[model samples]
Target: MGQFIISVGREYGSGGHYIASILAERFNVPMYDRNMLDQLAERNGIDAENLYKHEEMKRQGLHRTVRGHSSSVQDSIAQLQFNFIREKAESGESFVVVGRCAENVLRDNPALISIFVRGEEDAKVERISRLYKLNRIEAKAKMFRHDKKRKAYHNYYSKMKWGDSRGYDFCVNSSLMGVEATAEALYSMLSTYLKSKEQ
Candidate 1:
């Protein structure tokens, strides 16, 4: 059997992590998320907390010096994490990687399947609110801010937009389909894709 990879890009409250975890369980594969950051930090000789601090959110435009300093550190950490992703993918372990620009990092690998997960705004807001124990308005605002940061981070390092459908082999709407249904559909899709490639 050949190795497979799934990359999930999702909105802040879209339950992307949950869906990815489900798929990983069903497929009997490892899953990487923030834990990968800790591993990367250890390998790269950087502080894990500092790396996490720069993982999301963009620097404010004010204060040129501050922006430059933060960007440099963030870029270095991103590059190191990218290297770690490459190493993992090459290690013959089939897995699902959540965020950290894994799709962009593994774009050229023939053995990987890239997926993007998104949902309707209302569903996303409700999910975020319930999950984070925030009011609906606060959840909406937080979601917007998180998406903005994700867009900026992705655009800064990749040629493609973060959630753009064209960049992925599969684009799933978890709002309409739900997590279990989405995972089933993705499993079927992966089976077909792998079959076609083998022929």
Candidate 2:
């Protein structure tokens, strides 16, 4: 069987993780997300929490302050994580990897499909508020900040912009279609694509 890698880029509180998990279940494949940090920590002899800290960008005002520093620790951890992602992709196991620039990391691999999941701002705010138990206003502010960091992180490490349709095979709006429906749609699309590749 041909291996497949599905990379999901999502806006916070869009139920992106839920969608990825359901897709992995439907395909009987592994799902990699924050678990990737654990693997990287084990492989590099670093604390997993430390890896998480650098995985996303620092707050907005702090960016300028950290621009010029040569932080070998973060760089080494990122490289190790990239290597681990590549190794997993080449392992012949179909998997869904959320974030971590998996699309860029595995760009050279022809078997990969990159997807971006987004939702309307109001819907995202509602979901975030319920999921995180925050007020609507707080959730909205948090979502905005989170997306900014995610965009900066992706742009800083990869050539593609986060949530940019041009960078992905599919760009889905989960607000219009619920997470379950979105997962099913992606599965159908991916199955068809893989079958054609085999032909």
Candidate 3:
């Protein structure tokens, strides 16, 4: 087949980023995550660390825009990132992009394969707790906060709902079989998909 992109959208603490990384390794392609912001920052002379810290923050007193109008700094940065993602797609590179509304940004491309990952609430909380050294209650709270921000950010930037199964070509629950197994299953499915495309 030709160049294709794996665009993954996921809920907080779902191991979606880890899954995306595995798929990228299996496919021997680059994986784009929040690090895209660093590159964008460098290119545009922005502060990378500050951008990372505030990338998903919502600004008060600002309304969403259409017709190329951006009323907030976050919106401007998002537009720049979207343009960067489109450029990467146009460059004929096969890669996996995690979040940043990549599913919608590359929606029109035939090479796009969008995936959404979610997990059971308990699983998410546990994962977050272990990863960040927080207690279960704190982890649950953090997860909710992150998910809320993600939902808002994605909803504001894309036409589709974040983590909505209807918006993705494949939606998987990482909790059902754990993260590694989930990644393996997805990789197998993608392998079959690639073969079908070749035929």
Candidate 4:
């Protein structure tokens, strides 16, 4: 299998995580998602759960931006996490990294292939409601709120605008293609892409 670095940026309920899992299985590469937080916390002496909580708090405007925070704890995690992601690439390992601004972290690496996954609002809300057992209204709110948080996080952390199709090598709309189809398409495309690069 070709060694390729794939980073996926996605909106909530877009099946981004599922797509990444499929890719990792197909590529036989390590895939990282929330586990990156576990690694960051373990390495830096922070509680693992708090990493997610802190991010949520910041997203809700309960805390200032990482750079503006008085103690800058958020900033520290960002740096450590960025380093963690980079180190994985530096390890000469093929990987599918999802979220956490991984696209920005590895943007300069020639091996990097960034993908963005998006879906229609109704489709996303439907999936969120079904999977999470939330009511229609609750699911809608949760869905939109998540998008807002993601945009805030990406805008603050990366050069590319969150969910901008132009920034990624591939953009998939699961609303049209479905999760499995999107994953299959990505695998086929990435295989061809890696092969072309080797020629």
Candidate 5:
């Protein structure tokens, strides 16, 4: 088996993190998420807290940028993160990365499997409310806010539209069978697809 990569893009409150975890475990590969940014910052002498605070979302014009840089701090950090993702792929390793525009970064890799996970509005609200102990209205608002940020961040950096089915190998609705089943189904589909590719 050659190096394989799975880049998961998910909506907020859609159990994307959990689904990515399940896929990583099933594939027996390491998964990279926001924490990877912290590792990158530590290794490169960048401020991890500042990197995380503005991750995935761009800074507004009024906000102060990272010290000593004329450009947006988020843009610089995003480039570093993209480089890290490419280095990992070039190392001939199989891994999963959630968010961070990884799908676009590795779009040229033949073994890359990009996925976007979304769910029904009501389902997302229910999940968020339960997980955060927030009321349904609050959960819905939070979901909208997060989705907007994610969309903006992705659109700002990538040529493809965020969360669009055409941009991904698979776009699944987790509300139908929940996270566990969705992961399992995707795992099976990927397994078969890889086998077909081998043939």
Candidate 6:
């Protein structure tokens, strides 16, 4: 089997993480998301809590976070994550990585597949509300805030714009087909993508 690195970019509450998990199972490959931070902390001797506090969402705007931390912290963490991503890709294993601009890190890999997953506004709001146990209004506000942060972080780190269809090889409206079906769709498309590479 060919080694493929699948990078998933997504909107808040789009079920991107779940879909990536399913794909990992289908491919029998490891998946990384929040766990990336844990791995980084363990390997680099950084504090896990600090990494969590500054993860993709909060790293973009230093002034907006707690006082005394500068953009330097964000830069170091981002660079570490990118280095880890490249290390994983260099190992030449098939893996599904969610967010943290994995696509940007692995763009030069021949077997890389970048996907952006999104959902309808109302559906995403409902999904987030249920998952986080928040009311619909609160869910919408939370989702909006997260989307803004993610977009800012992604754009700040990568040459491509976040959520831009042109930036990815494929895009999925996960809500339209649901998580399982969306996973199947990605699997099928990835099969074709791999075969085309061989030809």
Clashing pairs in 3: none
In model 4, the runs with Cα more than 4 Å from the true position are 56-70
Give the distance in Å from residue 124's predicted Cα in candidate 4 to where it truly belongs.
0.5
Report clash pairs, candidate 2.
none
Q: List the residue pairs that clash in candidate 5.
A: none
Native RMSD of candidate 3 (Å):
1.8
What's the lDDT for residue 138 in model 4? 98
Quote model 2's TM-score.
0.89
lDDT of 6 by residue, 65-88 (tens): 336334567766877788888988
Q: Tens-digit lDDT track for model 4 on 8-110?
A: 8888999998999999999888898888888778877878978876552223324555555445566656666778889989988889988878888899898
TM-score leader: 3
lDDT of 5: 0.90
Per-residue CA lDDT of model 5 for 1-199, tens digit only, reads 6678999999998899899999999989999999888899889898789888888886567644467453767777888888899999999999999998898999998878999999999999999999999999899999999999999999887889999888899999999999899999999998888778777
Residue 86 of model 2: what lDDT?
91
Candidate order (lDDT): 5, 3, 6, 4, 2, 1
- Angstrom error of the Cα, residue 149, model 3: value is 0.2
**Candidate-wise lDDT, in order:** 0.82, 0.83, 0.89, 0.84, 0.90, 0.87
lDDT of 2 by residue, 1-199 (tens): 5888999889998888899998899889999988988877787687888877777552233222266543455555556667778988778778999988889999889878999999999999999998899999999999989998888878877888788899998988998987788888888888888888888
Order the candidates by TM-score, highest first — what do you get? 3, 5, 6, 4, 2, 1
Candidate 3 lDDT over residue span 82-169, tens digit each: 8888999999999999988988999899999999999999999999999999999999999999999989889977888887787899
Query: Candidate 4: TM-score?
Result: 0.90
TM-score winner between 2 and 5, please give it.
Answer: 5
**What's the residue-level lDDT of 161 in candidate 6?**
93
lDDT of 5 at 194: 78
- The segments of candidate 1 whose C-alpha lies over 4 angstroms from its true place after superposition are 57-71
Clashes of 3: 0
